[model samples]
Target chain A: DVKVTQSSRYLVKRTGEKVFLECVQDMDHENMFWYRQDPGLGLRLIYFSYDVKMKEKGDIPEGYSVSREKKERFSLILESASTNQTSMYLCASSSGPIYEQYFGPGTRLTVT
Target chain B: DQQVKQNSPSLSVQEGRISILNCDYTNSMFDYFLWYKKYPAEGPTFLISISSIKDKNEDGRFTVFLNKSAKHLSLHIVPSQPGDSAVYFCAASRGARAGNMLTFGGGTRLMVKP
Candidate 1:
């Protein structure tokens, strides 16, 4: 079975602080993605990496950055956490382009 | 401008009834469509998907219908169960290697009653 795991289920950070959200997948998928879920907004893509050392910005990439230094791990970084950035962060992995994506449970971050 | 749209914000249905969720997209280049279900505190999971060439696709109790000309798609859940209560998101993909990203709708919350 495919499994995606996040570093934390919940996280609290102060405003202006740098926060890192980590994700690891066991499936060794070639494509990994980061997304944020907000009320009524659904899942908005933040970033995605098609291969190691490669990254692409998604629709809402202004406040976020991603790193895929390794094949099994992808990390999302918040340079400066803001109140508006407090939301559910999700990580997903897919075996190929435009395929089914397996997701982690998600990390709910709160910026105070 | 939002390319994909889920007009309905929420829907309530009883068990054993059919629940229909609708979605529309403005981009005609979208050749593949998908539906995802998300529960509280969890990431959205892939539910079903359909290609532009096909009008409909079914998986167990879930069915997805696509209308290429109308730029619309809908998800139908037969005999809606309480566990089926969750938020449904509609997504579209353009099918290009460099631009193969899924554009998602806002989402529609569904509540299934026993």
Candidate 2:
């Protein structure tokens, strides 16, 4: 079975603080994605990596950055956490360039 | 402009009835469409998907219908259970070369009541 794990289920950070959200997938999928879910907005993609050391900005890449140094791990970074950045963060992985993604239990981050 | 849109913000349905959630997309290049179910504080899960070549795809209680010409899709849940009460999001992808990047619609919240 495919398993995507995030470092924390909940996180709290102060404004302007640097925050890191980690995700690791055991499926060895070639594609990894980071998304933020908000009340009115659905899951908005922040960043995605198709392969190691490669990344692409998604629809809402404004307050986020991502890194994929190894095949199984992808990390999302918040350079300066803001109140608007507080939302449910999700990590997903897919074997190929398809939308059939296996998702991890999301991390709910609260930026104060 | 929003590429994909779920017009309905919420829907209330009675148990054992059919619940239909609608989504529309403006991108003609979208060849694959999918539906996902999400509960509060949990990640969305892949529900069902349909290819542009086909009009409909069914997976037990869930059926996804795609109208390529209309650039629309809908997900139908039969015998809607209380557990089905959650937010549903519809997504679209252009092709494989797009690196599986999915453009999601604003979710529709479904409330299934007994």
Candidate 3:
């Protein structure tokens, strides 16, 4: 079975603080994604990495960036956290043509 | 605009009955569809999937039916159990994309009563 692990399951930060959320996959998948899920909005992509050092912006990438320094790890960075950024963040990884992504336990972020 | 939509926000079913969750899409380019189940404080887990070429796919008690002409799909759970209660999301993807990034619908929350 494939396993995707997130660094934190719950986090709290003050406004204007910078936050980093890390994800690691044991399957060595080539593609990793970061998504924020909000009530009534579903899951919206924030950023995705196809390979090491390569990143692309998704539908909702504002105020957020990503890092993929290694194949197994992907990181999501919140440049300046705000109360609006408080939501459940999910990390997923997939490989090959089968687009079946394995997800990690989400990180629920609270910005006060 | 929401590409994928789940019109019903919540559903209730009795245990041992059938639970039907529906999803609709506006994009004709979507060639693959998937269903995911999620619990509170947890990430969504892949449930079942169907390609454009097939109308139905089944795994155990869960089956997915796709209507390409209507651009809609539904997941049916037979003999629903209490453990099956969760939020169900419908997602679609264009096969031509490199990673096939998925566009998801607003989820439907399912509650099963015993």
TM-scores of the candidates in the order shown = 0.96, 0.96, 0.98
Write candidate 2's Cα lDDT for B10-96 as tens digits.
Answer: 999999999999999999998999999998867889999999999999999999999888899999999899999999999999787
Model 2 pairs in collision: none
By TM-score, the best candidate is 3
Superior by TM-score: candidate 2 or candidate 3: 3
Among all candidates shown, the one with the greatest lDDT: 3
Q: What is model 2's interface RMSD?
A: 1.4
The full ranking of all candidates by DockQ, starting with the best, is 3, 2, 1
The stretch of ten residues in a row with the least summed lDDT in candidate 3 chain A is A94-103
- Candidate 2 deviant stretches above 4 angstroms: none
The DockQ value obtained for model 3 is 0.77
List ranges where model 1 is wrong by over 4 Å: none
Residue B32 displacement (Å), model 1: 0.7
Candidate 2: TM-score, chain B only: 0.97
Q: Which prediction has more favorable DockQ, 2 or 3? A: 3
For candidate 3, what is the interface RMSD? 0.9
